[model samples]
Target chain A: MSEEHKHTNYMRIFWILLTLTIVEVGMAYTMQSHKALLIVALVTLAFIKAGMVAAYFMHLKLERKTFIAIVCFPLILAVVLVIGLFPDVGFKLGGKHHHKPAASQDSGHAVEHK
Target chain B: MSSVALAAHPPSQEKEILGVSSGKMAMWLFLGSDGMSFMGLIAAYVALRIGNWGIWPDPTKVLAIDLTAINTFILICSSVTMVKAFAASQEGNVGKLKQWLFFTMLGGAIFLGVQVYEYSQLIHHGVKLWDSAGRPAAEWLHPAIQGHSTLFTATFYACTCFHGFHVLSGVVYLAFILIGVMRGRWTVNRIEIVGLYWHFVDLVWIVIFTIIYLF
Candidate 1:
């Protein structure tokens, strides 16, 4: 790519990212009450911004298919990790409702670092 | 001459992956694993916050957004400069490469400085790493801690500080690259490799900013 062309592309991406951020912040304030919708919008916009950076600024778009595959292959594990953790953390697994009151007070005992 | 010709025409199929360098491959793998670690942290954060639900203090009430918004813009701008530096290096324009790399480093430094300021502010506002019990503690903590969870301070500190460390290291990385470029020891390949790391830092910040500050 020519220097001039690369410059234009980078600048364009910067503007787009800036605009998206502004929109995200704006939505954060305006949509404070609509909790579910706000979360969806915020997360979706964040991902779009991430994709733009990865594809253009990082030049992943210019890379070959093999290179893209090599880089993306590990993300499968990441997705699985997030999914597997959601049930335990976010949802009540196995439908057995266990009311554990000590869980909150046990915060002090949490996260013992070696 | 016949042996030389035979050697030259030895391979018809592909032997080397086109345009993919070892440095890039390594960086990508590093970023991939680093990303997973970050994902784990974020997922844990989401789980903890959502599980607690209503007892947590509103993040906006406890945190400053205007300053962080500026910091986020600085990082985005730095990513642009980093990309520009890589382009200049590819063109073999040493002067532009050095200039943009320095600017990129400057941006990273400013971002770190702002983060330090934010951390100090949070600390002053009574955000502590943990109490004597190792649990997260904070001054602005809601009073309804009867049974719900309250680990906001811990999660916020862990996530932001990890990202701040990355920014600090990126600044150091760029500084070294700047010195090497001045001494003519670094090439376009080196800049490209470091650029991958720099951009990855910026990318992670985008996610962190959204999750921690925005929502």
Candidate 2:
């Protein structure tokens, strides 16, 4: 195995997670008003964390295709299930009036002029 | 060469039944079903909380993120150690595998320990799983405060504490595997199977970290 490559990846992931976590704290403290930005930031950071773990720690970069496929398929199915449950998940999270309606609804980002 | 060409072909259809081991397969299925179970709880919360016309809690405002963030690091570290254990086994270094397994177990224990501490802090902060200072949820501090509902705390404790229980089981699993290694019952394949379970546990935590703590 390429030891240096693994080391560099680990270090990079460490720095990225640290930076993102710091940003999370900063945003939490700084951002005010129930705006869309905070949610976007949190989710983006989450996906980044997931990416790093999958690539490095899980060795997805080096994993066999069959195993990777097995893992990925289930995760995809899961995301779909969660997405399908958006109405329920949305309410559980906070509510429509809690914010995001003006940004998410009809004639909003859900459907575009283009 | 004729021999080399023949080796590339698939094994004949009439062969022994072999695929993912039943135990490992069962574990994966269990994890998958558990994931759905959690998604259902969370989804129900989201749905009902929304329907409540803004009665639920603001997750970020109330959760002790710093403690949980450290918990995240601890769990992720365990995942790294687990893979290391698998790697050691692959390299035929049983001693290294045992050491890594011990560290992996240590990491898991630290996570559970931290979680217990966090729970204590929350309870002290006037939020118990079944009661918010002995008043109805709507009567407590603002629902937007994140721990408003007895329901909220109930789900929180149930979800995370259940996850912790799995981590504990994994600790025992590692112990069995370690003892097996000492008795030379382990093959590289066994390491892979255990590593797969460990990895799945870590994966579940990753999602839990996002939903429970961050999102």
Candidate 3:
């Protein structure tokens, strides 16, 4: 009941989200050449905006710590899932072998070799 | 027997699991699972893009960044309105609650409309779910992709369309809640639950927009 009565400055959170979004778009355009840096910056800004919304707007900040811990479980799994895929997809370990046939076709070597 | 049970344990003594109402806890659980689904889609997108890093078309070159940025702003505005509605409900202000809820729904509707428009434009420019011919008519498409698979457009359509459907569903869900409010059957807890769903939609979009459009 005490948590329910807590005050949240929804407008302030709104402004922060708005400002972060503006900065995201501006960085997207200005830092396109530095692809890695741009991705890190934009993703960081996005997470900040999302965290603010969840905390202030959704009132997760007012909830019990146990409830917050419960919510974090799936999010942690999601990060794990992404990182697990890095070796296969991101590094393309066996990808080149699989792509060989298609690469040959693209280079017109398939018809010539046949 | 029910009356005896109720008398034994008054409403105030009812157990609250982790200090959350059952309804709100259920909503949070659902949001968590739903978030994992979106994460799956996003992970697939990242995998495809990385696997074909050299040939994957630059998103900024193909997608309308400015339009989507504006659309993102619209969605953020709607999230704010949704929270405002919840606050109004907490205050027991029916009139203000209804007003803010209507605004939130309007924002979602506008967002969906813009998404449909963007889809149409992309389709006109030759983006398809699966191009059997293996040639999308987009000139900006890489020469290497002319005769290969259309993973770029395919993943783009899949991710955006799924999110668009969520927005559409959210609008309809809010419409039902708005009807309930009109009939004087609304509760603060109910409004708060729906607001959680709405805000989660906004949250998912924040990630998708960055990974899909801005990345």
Candidate 4:
């Protein structure tokens, strides 16, 4: 009985992943007009896929409920650091700034590189 | 009295080297650390992207969707086979274990093959790394692709290539365990640990497939 339950859960996980991938593809289609909405959809799909893998594929569900929290909390911290560091590192390294339009910024940076 | 009793009794579960099975729990902890590494990479992607939208590439156009979806399906199937291998090993069914492991290995190989082909195809179409110079993919000629495409290619290479590396390591890891099966060293507990790592790799790809390929 317990064995059968595991198999059924596995099937459910497969379907859930399939559905999430489809949503991700669908969102990609709307990139031209609804950029914000598409970004939201992409993030949502990525989160769902991440959740499924951790819970099902990684056996976090089978191991212990606490494992999920332990794994996720540190990841969230790493994300915070990445976001915090980007403005300083990325903009400083490039001779260009993201705030300005590419059209206006390109003339100097382009000539220098070429 | 001491040596004979210790040999006969075997330590209790709690009294083992670790409070839990040392190796299995250790692998889980290692994965926890690995999870952080990937998170850092993803965070780098988001930051660079938001900060430099002008130069980042459109992922949808540069990446071929259909082929990657197929690769995703292959990975999902491999996860299924991995679970079955664990089940078979528990029941002492050597034949089933070998069959499932074989399928899992084949799936990993196919994933790697497709990735190599994809890289070549991208390069052929002018998506060279280390400098998109002299490639049809990047130049000062077209401005739209410059910010986005370059960003897209860099992120694409970093994410997928890292994921692909994990897949390759997994293949080697699984092969070593398969060798154990032939030699009767493989056991249910051992396969479970291998399965843990295998599943973590699969999980990493799941996120990559959604973020990098589909959306």
Writing each residue's lDDT as its tens digit, candidate 2 over A1-114 gives: 685566556656766766776676667656646446876776677767776666676566675677557656766776676666555444333324334445554433353223
lDDT of 3 at B196: 95
Q: Please say which candidate is ahead in TM-score: 2 or 4.
A: 4
Better of 3 and 4 by DockQ: 3
DockQ of each: 0.50, 0.24, 0.55, 0.32
Q: Report the Cα lDDT for residue B124, model 3.
A: 61
- Candidate 2, B149-187: lDDT as tens digits: 556666677778778888889888888998898888776
Measured by TM-score, the strongest candidate is: 3
Instruction: Give me the runs in candidate 1 sitting further than 4 Å from their true place.
Output: A1-3, A93-96, A99-114, B1-18, B130-148
Superposition TM-score, candidate 3 onto the true structure: 0.85
Error of 1 at B205 (Å): 0.5
lDDT of 4 by residue, B96-134 (tens): 999999899999999999999998887766565554455
Model 4's chain B yields a TM-score of: 0.85
> What is the TM-score, restricted to chain A, for candidate 4?
0.65
Give lDDT per model, in order: 0.80, 0.66, 0.83, 0.74
Deviation in Å, model 1, residue B199 alpha carbon: 0.6
TM-scores of the candidates are 0.84, 0.73, 0.85, 0.81
Q: Give one digit per residue, the lDDT tens place, for model 1 in A1-114.
A: 366876788999999999999998888888889989998999899889988999998889889988888777766786787666654655542232345444533332232111
TM-score of 1: 0.84
Task: Indicate the DockQ of the complex predicted as candidate 3.
Answer: 0.55
Which ranges of candidate 2 are over 4 A from the true structure?
A: A1-15, A32-35, A63-67, A88-114, B1-31, B49-53, B131-149
Interface RMSD of 1: 1.7
